[model samples]
Target chain A: MSDAETTIPRPSLGRLFWVFLVMGATSLGGGVVAYLRTGLVVRQRWLDDVTFVELLSISQTLPGLNATNMSILVGDRLRGGMGALVATLGMCLPGASLMIAAGFLYGAGGDGPWSKAFLHGIAAGAVGLILVVLVQLGAKTLKTFADYVFVVVTAVAVAFFKVPVPYALIAAGIVAIWWHRPRDKDVR
Target chain B: MKQLWDLAGVFAYLSLLTIGGGMAAFPEMKELTVDTYHWVTFPELLHFYSLGQLAPGPNMMMVASIGVTVAHIPGALVALVAFFLPTGLLTFFVGRLWTHLATWRWRPAIQTGLGSVAVGLVLAGAIIMGRGAITQVFFGVIALAVFLLLWRTKINPAYPIVASGLIGMALHYFNIA
Candidate 1:
């Protein structure tokens, strides 16, 4: 929709795959979005800022992981179905291979005391990382008092009551959507 | 063969539950993988998850780890395809249809509604993970320190997390924790 989409030379699907593969390998520390913006917008000029943000919004609203979804959407926009497949594969392959290796290593020696201590400590730290993510997401998403209520209800249903996630997701999602349903007096 | 199918089914199901992020499905992932399937223990799940955070791509690639643990290369391949394919298809279709729905009035409601709920899910996940992860004094301190550092600084997360592992090793070596 932006001028760049029209002006930028369309890259070949192989090129698309290679670019995304580079991104997948280098985007450390879980900030794939930032890396995406730099690669697609700043460097490749494949998409301008506005278009990049628009695609990112779609990625967030959808049910897939942000990184993979962004790759699919961007790749689809660039070169169609094959592009999407290549991009998503490129984005995922590096991490998937690393994790599989981690799995094999853990299986081999994960039960030793040293490994136990190391894993335990990393798990604790990962908890902190998750908390940071939660706060950032909450700050971005929770805008109203009622929204806060929905969050608490949903959290309680899952964490305390052990309600199944799908049930909680559906029930809370329906209620929250209806609560935010269009009001005649409301102006966007 | 049964293990492969189970791995596929479990991860495919878990994949859909990741609304806001993979962490949103953590409790359920734990419930099924650790408690139900007995594919991995709680600590092992936690370990895989922690290591996953260090991985460069999507945060939930740990599903591959679980697959490898449960079966092997076939399990790993099956898990990756299963975890990704369903949601990947959904995303592709919905993404194509996104612009056509922009003018619809309920779009904002759907976004806002799902937004808060997604946050809640992440909070619940953090709590569940914390319960298992922060069981000791040193571990708790590590969590708190990492939280504060991340909140205040722009440092890459991998450093603190790797440091946390090293600190644990050191503490164990010194018999301090």
Candidate 2:
């Protein structure tokens, strides 16, 4: 059958490997920042703003690995189930293999000068990249005054308040859900 | 194996909490697996956390690593399935519903509200990231400058990441923290 004919078959393992590799290679600093990088397909090519924004939204909202969500979105767009499977696996494998290797290498000794230096540059550079993500994403979503306030408040709450992660998440989630829940337009 | 099943249960639980993805869930995972369960020690968990960080596919990768460490291949399988299946089903269903519901005016309001929530979640994520990465003032400054540069530069993600690594090396050579 031609490639288009298949709707949701299991993806070929080899193709999945490449997809995994691409995601793996790009996510250098780790998961915290990699989504911004892997988002290039939407940012640089193929997808448009509204569509890309929507994809990102779905990816972020979903509970699975963000990278996997991204990959599945990309994969389903390209080929179908096989593609998604490939993408998810592709996105995941690098970290898995790398971790295993690192596990083997764990406690090998102290950090070498180069490793330390490399990590330092990464640590610094990652901040810049993450900052960029925050701004760009913010611009897309934060049009109103309320949004602006939310961002400011949340940043302070976490960075300074040092509220534990789960509580912060729950608290913010409650606020947003309640804030957005359908209200009587006339009442407002 | 019993170990695999246990990993599955943990991953399943963790997946439900990933409202904003891995970073959103990191602290929770760190607490449950690292502190509460003591399945992995803090420092050891940190290493796997690093692997989860640099791993290519998804931040949830720590599940597989965690599983593997806990119980070999089956452990990995349990963790993977536990983490993935529930979330995938839920997301796909939610996506369908979200699209169907997009016609509502209140959708925009809801989105706006969620946007705020995302900010809060990410803010929390950044704090977690910061506590780990920022050991001293020099590193802290680097993070700040880098955040600004990303906003202004429109540079490819790779460039910044690579530059950071190189920058890390430079700091080491110069004896800068």
Candidate 3:
């Protein structure tokens, strides 16, 4: 319901696809969100910062990859159903093709000691990358002492006790939601 | 054929568990793909995952790698569609409904509540992956170094990650690790 939504011109489906395709092909490393913000808000000028953040919040609240979810939401906003389709396809195509090719290559030459050593090192580096993501996510999402407790309980249950993720997600999710339930006094 | 079906079912199921991000589904993905299906060994899973990080788009696109391993191109196709389609549809419909739910009372609660749990899931994933990836002290140092560099700087992550690989190669040449 922002002015940008009404003011911005709707892009053609092809344009949408092309724009997202470029983002998919160039958003190197793991931080697709920053690249997305640059492409959509800064470069394309299709959405303002507020709208972008709002859509990003929705993307985060939902259960999908942020990059693809953002693509669908933004694409839907710009050009409706076909826009969503093309955007998701464009965003996924580059990585998908590369990974498929990687699969073939790995199958052919993966067992070599050199390849194994390199993969091992990168895997360790990836663990570092994931830790950074976790710390950043925790800072943004976690607030109260109880919230930290929820994080620990969930982590221990899953990683240590080997509790299935679904069970842990459901049990922790319900409790956390109820604890944060809107109180009548705090109506905003 | 059966392998294709298995790939579809497993990835489709796995997709729903990725609430916060792809990492949230890592442990379960490990369970099904490595322990149960034997499609790829643990080291191979870690390799694909790290390489996926280097890939340009979604980090979890490596799911296709597993599928390709199991059943070639067909497996990849099935895994991609299955992994994406259900969640894509859910997102499309829910995104439309989001505007209507803007003022709903429980909206804030749902957002905040899920946010914490999602963080926990990602943490769990990191721990599980660390167990597999940080086998040696040298690798541990690499992980910590990358963590500090990324935590403090604005540099592109790809650079440090590639350097880590090169360091590994160097170590191998010198028979250090």
Candidate 4:
């Protein structure tokens, strides 16, 4: 039989949910993408490397969290709409539950001096983390001098002028896309 | 009833702003959730965001905290569903059409353009958040140190963040902060 004809059957919806649940529960420190590649591409063979990358690019390009986007894309590819539903729920449930519990805990004790101090410290540390993420993303995505210029302009627009994020996003996005518009000389 | 509707509307709106990642939505999230609706304080928003970084799934699951703060478990469910659904449907339909558009000449342009802007938005978010997060000299030092460490080292981020929190507690005990 051809590789197409003898392909592994689609995983059951329950198994899809179970696998995503395990991934969602175990993917620590915000590296869900790596865990996802390992689980879906390497271990389970639900998708090949090329398809995984394609889905990932889609996830990144769209406006959503990568983990949930990946879950929706991958699950849909595997078992249609119901698969997408289950996968997204599985991915979100563990973390959402914890955060809800955290809300209750903070409501109760967040005003205590020690809790206040701790939360403040973590906030500062999270700033560092966000900065790191910004730098890494910049390194990967930015190419041209104009691209760097767009980044700075957009940042200043929001951070200094208080231009709303949606406005900045649209304004910068339009300019950047027009600048990079199909260059005939550099045609791929 | 109206509160839940408001929660749903706010998150759904914030959801679209998350182009690059959850951080891309931070500024608007702060504007609507903290400033507009008063569902949580700035410090509380920061706290939930920080806690979310340590959580196991999608980083933006912190929205659940805001929901719970507003209306308990049902609120949390509403927020999550609202935040995810609109973008989720977009991705589903777009992902299907993406393959046919692979050969479209403008695809690369759109990708590269959006990529840079997304980075900028995340930078903008960090700046806005920094105003609140980096209040004191010690806090600034902690942020700088964590930045350098994460930039240079392969260590997991949780260790340093948790350590920073413990140090904060100690500093407060000693009347430093």
Q: Give the i-RMS of model 3 in Å.
A: 0.6
Interface root-mean-square deviation for each candidate? Answer: 0.8, 3.8, 0.6, 0.9
Which residue runs of candidate 1 sit more than 4 Å off their true CA positions? A1-5
What ranking emerges by TM-score with the best candidate at the front?
3, 1, 4, 2
Instruction: Give the per-residue lDDT of model 1 (tens digit) for A1-188.
Output: 68746675679999999999999988878878889999999999999898898888888877879999999999988988898999999999999999999999999999999998898888999999998988888888888999999999999999999999999999999999999999999887
lDDT of 1 at A148: 98
B96-160 per-residue lDDT for model 3 (tens digits)? 99989999999999998999999999999999999999988999999999999999999999999
Q: What alpha-carbon RMSD in Å does predicted model 1 have with respect to the real structure?
A: 1.5
Task: Give the Cα RMSD of candidate 2.
Answer: 5.3
- Tens digits of lDDT, candidate 2, A83-187: 666666666666666655554444343146566556555645554554555566677667767667766776666657756655665676567657667666644
lDDT of 4 by residue, B1-177 (tens): 999999999999999999989999998998899999999989889999999988889999899999989999899989998999999999988987888999999998999999999999999899989999888899999999999999999777888889889988988999999
Q: TM-score for the first chain of model 4?
A: 0.94
- Cα lDDT for residue A66, candidate 4: 96
Q: Count the backbone clashes (under 3 Å) in each candidate.
A: 0, 20, 0, 0
The candidate maximizing DockQ is 3
TM-score, chain B, each candidate: 0.98, 0.76, 0.98, 0.98
lDDT at A124, model 4: 89
Instruction: Mark the regions of model 4 whose C-alpha exceeds 4 Å error after superposition.
Output: A1-9
